[model samples]
Target: MRKYSIIFIFIAFVCHFVTGQNKQLLYDFSEIPQSLLINPGTETDFQWYSGVPILSGISLQAGSSGISVNDLFANDGIDFNDKVRDRLINGMSPKDDLSGTYQIELINIGYRGAETDNFYSFGIYNEGDAIGYWFKDYAKLGFEGNADNLNNRFNLSHLKTRGEILNVFHFGVTKEIDNKLTFGVRGKLYSGIIDFTSTKNKGYFVTTEGQNNLLSNTLSADLELKSSGIITLDHVIDGDSSAGDMIKRGFFGGDLGLGVDLGFTYHLNEQTLITGSLLDLGFLYHSTDVLSYTLKGNATVEGVEIILPDAINDPNTDFWQDLVDDVEGLVPFEENRKSYITFRPTKLYGSLRYNFGETVQSKGRLDCDCNLSGGKSNRTKYANGVGGQLYVINRPRGPQAALSAFYQRRFGNIMAVKTTYTIDKYSFSNVGLGLNLQAGPINMYFMADNLLAYRNIAASNYASFQLGINIISWGKN
Candidate 1:
C-alpha cells in the first residue's frame, strides 16, 4: 500500500511538471534585461543596467501534453484503481514526458562601452534542467502482473531520463555594425554540480506458453545509468561536510565546459525587423565523482516438470531458487566508476516584428538620439509593436517547438506591457502576459503563462512564472 502511494505521488508530479522550455512572453521584450539572456542582439535603448542580485532574474516553467491532476486525484468520485488503469496505464504513451527548467541569476550587469559605443554585459547564474519520458508498458506490467498478461512484450526501452544542476558564467557584447544589422555573441563557461542520466535503453520482457511447463518467461535487457558529483553532495546533505564544500564543487570548481550564444537583429526597413538566436552550443565532461551502472543480456526460464508421482515425493525441490540463479547468470548487472560527456541542450529562437505608432521619447533624451551609440540608428521607439516568434529546444527524444504571436504597448520608459497567444504541444490557448515598470532608477518586471490555469494550478496542464528587479541609468544626459 505504501509503495502504491509513492507511485501515485510520482504520477502526480510528472503530470504537473512535464513541459517544454519556452519563454515567449519575455523573449524579445527589450524593456526587461533578462530578455538579453535569450537574444543578446535584442535592440536596447538603455544606457546601463544592473540586476538586484538573486531577485533580478528568477524563472520556473512546468507543463505537460498529457493528463492533468484532475484526471486521477480530482473529486470525481471514481475508484482510484480505475482511474490509474484508464488514465495512465491505458491513456498515456511512451512519448509523453515529464520535464521542467529553472534559472536564477546571481549577478547581472550591463553597461555601454564609452570607448566603443558597444554594449558589454556579464553575469553568473545557476540553472537546472530535467526531463523523463513516460514508460507505459512498464507501468502497465507493474500494475497488473504478467499472470494475467501472457505473450505480451513489455518494453524496457521506455525508461528515459536526464537531469542536471550547474552554474554558468557568461560575458557578452552587442555591437551595431551598421544601421540595418546589429549582432551580438555571448561566451559561457559551465560548471556542473550534480547530474544523472539514463536515456539509451533496449530490450523487453515476455511470458509465453511452454511445452514442458505451464509457462515460459523471457527477459532481454540493455540499460545504463550515469551520474557525477551526487556522492559527495549526499554526504554534505547528511551533515558530514560543510555547505562550502559543495559550493566549491560549483562555480568553476567542478566539471567544466564551454559554450556560446549568437544572435542578430536585422532591420528590413525602419519599422519591420527580423531576429534570431542560437544558444548553449557546448558540452560537459564528467570525470570527478563519477559512477555508472549497466545491465545487459537475455534470459529464459520455465518451471520444473512436475511428474504427478515424482512431485509428491520431492516437495522440497527449490524450483524458484534455481530459476532465480539461472536468470542472474544469463543477465548480468554491473556498476563501474567510468566518466562520460554530456552535450548541452541547445536552443533556437527567431522572430519577426513590426513597429507602429509615433515615436515616444521620455525623460533625458537628445533631440536626435544618435549620440547614444556613435551613429546608433536614430530609429524611433514606437508606442506599439506586434510580432511572431518561434522557439525550439533539443531534448533526449527530439526537438520540441512552440510558436507565439504577441502584441506590445509601451508608455515611454515608464511602463511596458506585452501579451501573447502561443500554440505548442502542451496547450493551444496558452495566454502569456508580462509587465515592466521603471520608477526613477529602479526597474522591475513580471511575466507568466497559462493564465487560464492560474485559477486552478493543480488542474493545469502547463504553467510558468518569471519576475525580476533591477536598477538602470540612461547615462548623464
Candidate 2:
C-alpha cells in the first residue's frame, strides 16, 4: 500500500510540471485589456495639446489587495467523496469558477523634444501574487483478509502556482513628422527574481470500527471503491512537505518593440482637433523552474482480515528519496533545472479625440475622449482580453495652481475619479473611490491595492501603495 501511494505521488508531480508550462491555458481568462491600459495612443488626447518642453512626469499605479491560492481551494470546504476528489486530483477539464487575484504596478518618466516635440520615455514595472490551491484524494487497494485498511488510504493535496518580481526598464522615443504623423520606437531591458513553489501533501488513513466501519470493510475487501467511499477512512499518515528546492535560482532575459501615433484637425474645425496613436509592440522573456514528485502504494494478502499500518513511510532519514525513486523509476537528480517561457507583451492601440470650444476658451478648454485597446499573446495557451476608458478633462488655472478633473473607466467595470494639481514643474495626480486613494506626480502615482481587509485584519486591512518617477533629458527634436 505504501509503495502504491508513492507511485501515485510521482505521477501526480510529473503531470503538474508538464501542465505548468502551459500557463496560458490555466490563465487564459485573466488576459490584460490592451485598449484601456497598455496603449498610450489610445489616451494621447488627454495629454496637453500645446506640448511642453521636457515632458517629464512620473506615474505609479498599483492594485488594492493581494489574494492567496489556499483561499480559493478552501472556499467550498474540503470534500472527502471519492469521485469529487478524483476529478480534482487528476487534471480535470478547465473550469471558469477558479478564484484568485492579480496585482501590478508601473512607473514611467520621459522627456518631450521642444523643437520637434519628439519624446523619449523610460519606466519600470513589477507584478507578483499567490494564485490558488487544488486538492485531490487517492485510495489504496488491499486484498481480502488484509487488516491494515488504514495504510491503503492516501489523500493528496497539491498547489499550482507561478509568480515573479520583475523590473522592466524601457527607453522609447517618438518623432513627430507633422500634425498628422508620428513615429516611435522603444527598447526594454528586463531583470528580476522569479520564485515558484509547488507542494504535494499525502495522508494515510485506516477506517475505525465505530463511525468509519464502512470504510474499514471497503478497504479490507479489496473492493474498487468509488470516489465517495473514502470519506470515512481514518487518517494514518500525515505527510506534508515542500518539494522542488531549485526555485532559488533566478535568471535574466530581454525583448524589443516599436509604436506610432497620429493626430489631425479637419478644415471644417478651427475649433475641433482629432488625435490618436498606435501603442505597445513588445515581448518578455520568462524563466521558470520545473519541480517533480511521485507517490505509490503496495498491498499484500493475509487471512480473512486486513491489517494496515499507521505510517506510510519512515520518518527518520531517506524515506522521501526512496519513495520518489520507487514511483519515478530512478531518474538522475539535478539541483538546477531551468526553462525559458516567452510571450508577446500585448498590442498597441489607437483612439480619436474631439476638442470643443477652441474659439471661446483661452486658457481653459474642454475635451471628450474615447479609447479602445486589446492584448493577444503569440502563445495560444495564454489568455486574451479587451478594455476601454472614457473620460472628460477640464483644465482650469488659479493664482497658485492648475487643476484638472477626470473620470476614467477600467476593466469594463471599474470607474474612478482622477484629479491633478500642478505647482510649477511638479504635478500631482490622484485617483480613487471609497477608501482607496492614489496620489503622486504626473509620471508617477501611489495607490493602496486593497481597502477592505478580507480575512486577517492586521496584514490584509492596511493600505499597500507604490511610488514611481520618470526622467527624460532630451529627444524633443
Winning candidate number (TM-score): 1
TM-score of each: 0.91, 0.37
Worst 10 contiguous positions by lDDT, candidate 1: 364-373
What lDDT does each candidate get? 0.83, 0.27
Q: Clashing pairs in model 1?
A: 18-63, 18-99
Model 1 residue runs over 4 Å out of place are 1-20, 304-325, 362-375
Q: Please write out the lDDT profile of model 1 over residues 231-285, one tens digit for every residue.
A: 7666665668778876886776778888999999988877888999999989889
lDDT at 146, model 1: 93
Alpha-carbon RMSD, candidate 2 = 17.1
**lDDT by residue for model 2 over 1-477, one digit each (tens)?**
874475345333322221101011011011111111232222121122211222211122211112223333444555644433343334332111121222233544444445434555555444332222332223122212235545444333322332333345555555544433344455655443333333323333334443323433212111110111011111212232122111122124221222222222111122222333322233334333223233334322221222245233433445456545543342222233343332322222222223232121111111212111111100111011212222211111111112222222222112122222111111132222211111221222233323343344333311233222222121221
lDDT (0-100) at residue 360 of candidate 2? 17
